[model samples]
Target: ILIDGALQNLDFSSGSVEFHNLVIERELNQKVMGGTEDEIYIFYMRFRRGIRVGIRLSKKILLIQLEIDSGFRNGTLGLLGTFNDNQNDEFVLPNGTVFISGASQTDQNLHLYGLHWRTQEISSLFKYDGTQSWSSINNLTFVPLFFNPNLTAFIPNATIRRYAQDICYGEGLNDPTPEQRKPCYFDFSVTFDADIANDTEKTLKTIDTAKKTL
Candidate 1:
């Protein structure tokens, strides 16, 4: 957490804290987490002139909500991509190249675009404890994007992709829709668990509710 313009390492296991009018709250809501998220914390901050940010943490989820005035439109770029109305221009590289060999939102294009924006530990702005290093992900369920791209061990296969599509677009889900398949595929690729897509569904709904209320 960054407080008073200083970078501070925060531990939310103890209790909630109020600093400089920012609220760091801890709440237990089993229903919302599908009775699996043991730890849940919500941090909300409001900036002057209608720039607000909300961060919600669950067991295996980190959701972010942003509210910015249209005045700053098309003025930002990062993992979330451009904030402009043109969605086709997203996945742009640092060199401002939107397409290399071809255009469109293909897997190859997205991989290159996301890889360009990947941050290194040395260039990170936040503090780190160094307890869990990126190199120690040998036994993790999913490999981080920092891993070597040449290895296909962590990449999704045709069968896994089919399963993710079925679970995300399947009927009787949490408002399952065709458009939601992208996020669901991401979660599925990470965990290789079809049920993981449910978390993405719930998170989207949570974001929508926050937009309406705050």
Candidate 2:
């Protein structure tokens, strides 16, 4: 799905969708120090078997080009989606994406958040990944991203990503506490780096944040 941009043409003959090479944001210029399409943030993603292997965006590129300065903020961010299994007590994002715990954060009392691709809701921004963030599916990666008001973008730190991947892929501790009698969830931070821009275009960056446990 290509958000923040308009498709000028579309074709579906080759078992794939094709665009006319014109994304609306590309037509705008910000030379006059005012309003322009250049200020609009664009996020382009192509999914393959539930994994986002490719992405195209304007802001992330701009940030690298400008090199305005960047650093990873404290805290881990995770990516969450709809739980597709027959599990109960699931959390749903505003966009109707349900999430199951394919991986765990380092923090036992992890915060969870519901997310829609493009939303202005606080739920989309942050939430605690508590008990409600679990799914019955085995060996599925559930990565999540948290919104950082300081950076004005959603991102996750490397520590959390590795931890989540380990737990989700069955590479971490598998013991569960007697109270819950279930495997323990991993914990990590949502820290990320950014060029520190108020404009959405310069702040938004693509990342493979969090994942679910097996």
In model 2, where do residues sit more than 4 Å from their true spots? 1-26, 31-56, 61-140, 147-194, 197-214
Model 1 residue 66 lDDT score: 84
Estimate TM-scores for all models.
0.52, 0.19
lDDT of 2 at 167: 35
Write one digit per residue (lDDT tens) for candidate 1, span 1-214: 6554456887667656556655465555444434464555556566555576878764456778887878778876756667898876655677776653344565655665666676666665544444654445334343344322222343346555456555655543332344444566567666665455776766677787899998
The TM-score measured for candidate 2 stands at 0.19
lDDT of 2 by residue, 1-214 (tens): 3223332453333434533542222212333111434443323223322222222344333321211112312111233322334333244444445434445432222344422333333434333234322233222446554323221121145454444334323355432321121111211122121221222222122112222221
Best by lDDT: 1
lDDT of 1: 0.59
* RMSD to true structure for each model, in Å: 7.7, 19.5
Clash pairs for candidate 1? none
